[model samples]
Target: MNLIQGYDPDTLRELVDERECAERLAEIESQRSLPVLLERVWLLKVLDRLDEALELAEETVRQARMAGTRKDLLRARVLHATVLQNRGAHAAAAQELAHCANEAEGRGWFGIAAFAHQHHGRNAYEAHDFDVARESFKRSLFLRREAGADDTELEKALRAIDAAERRSAEAPGVLV
Candidate 1:
């Protein structure tokens, strides 16, 4: 199996240096592979290339919907949600992520389920719906914990929940 198969895209992202990642991802995209396209979109999202990511994610969603596989569909949906979140469309992002979470949970894709919840948490946080943010972050924390996500991510999620709760409880009218 190739390195791409041996390692999850998220982990591989961490391993690759930021400066060179785009080049590597571009090589993968040259193959015109669906999964690779989704991965590239994800990488673009992470790199803050929001518009480009959105374009790829939209295409990924269309293609994955045609495939009719729950896993592929969920992946594309999650990426689309993430790109939407990057673009500040929090409500729609949450809707997309919630759909992905429902499907991934049903299919027992624990990691995808966790990521979906995490994306929802991020959307809620960005929207300043702190109560919902806290709930979503807590839900994501639980799911990510069950998925065996690294302690760093679990701790970060917990911290995010705490922070959101703190932000929510702060005296209103103060610039948070």
Candidate 2:
């Protein structure tokens, strides 16, 4: 098994060598622990290996629920929702994001809540529900700011909010 030594998820480099990361993760995945597996799943997502990520993400969620902490479960769920959204499974993704958002909010995990709201907004945006998307993105930005999240993440959320607002403004008169 290929053990990915020396790569810390919390301190992941600004510009990751994703292919190398993925290769290293894959080398030891079968022998890896849950945390490493989860990181691998995320790396695969970054690599746009959605099918593989989705498969591993599902298993991660199941394993997390079975033996991991609540935070672990939340992470897995967020990953699952991301894969679903990337695959255009908007409704399912929305459901997962809503669950994650509610749970994170209840736990005062504002950063996770912000992430969920951001993805929820993306799901709505994909569905053409501009008004709902706009609201969701606004909520996400507010939560992220309150959480003192990274500036880059805040900027991305702001961009999404702007796009949603633009769409809402341009949408024709039709009952939503």
Candidate 3:
């Protein structure tokens, strides 16, 4: 549980070995490293081991709260919401993301705020709420750009926006 030895969120997302990440993180569970726990949850989700991911996510949120660290708690909440989103629980995910987005904004954590809004957009897109998805993605992109986020994040936001727009155009009852 070396505080200085952890992967960045972007690196975790880009990792080709999800199972390795999960195992490596789990090995440090005794150390109670919040970052490792959160990353493990993300890796589990990527592996489509939703039940394990959800369990770890909930535990991470609880541990983060008990640790009295706002940053860790915010990160845990976002990861938890992502598990819910992956599980197709859109409403719950959206609710969590909304709260997360507001909290991150109030705390001036623009990176987390951007992440929250991006997932919020993903939830909306899954629910076929293209307009809401588009707006959320736009907000996310703005925040990411303002915060000097990496190009990967900006590209992801743009892709979400494009997907929402394409969906909106194809939906019935839309003007041609």
Per-model TM-score versus the true fold: 0.78, 0.77, 0.82
lDDT of 2 by residue, 3-35 (tens): 333322221212356668677766767765788
Model 2: lowest-lDDT 10 consecutive positions: 5-14
Worst 10 residues of 1 by lDDT: 5-14
Give the C-alpha lDDT of model 2. Answer: 0.79
Q: Could you tell me how far off, in angstroms, the CA of residue 13 lies in candidate 3 after the best superposition? A: 10
lDDT of each: 0.76, 0.79, 0.82
Q: For candidate 3, lDDT tens digit of each residue in 1-176?
A: 22223223322222246556556656765665887788778777877889999999999999999984898898899899989988989999999999999999899999989989988887888788999989999999999998999987788788778878988898998587
- Judged by whole-model lDDT over C-alpha atoms, candidate 3 comes out at 0.82
- Highest TM-score against the true fold, candidate: 3
Candidate 1 deviation (Cα RMSD)? 5.6
Worst 10 contiguous positions by lDDT, candidate 3: 6-15
Which of candidates 1 and 2 is the stronger one according to lDDT?
Answer: 2
Candidate 2 ranges beyond 4 A from true positions? 1-31
Rank order (by lDDT, best first): 3, 2, 1
Residue 172 in candidate 1, Cα distance off native in Å: 1.2
lDDT, candidate 2, at 106: 91
For TM-score, candidate 2 versus 3, the one ahead is 3
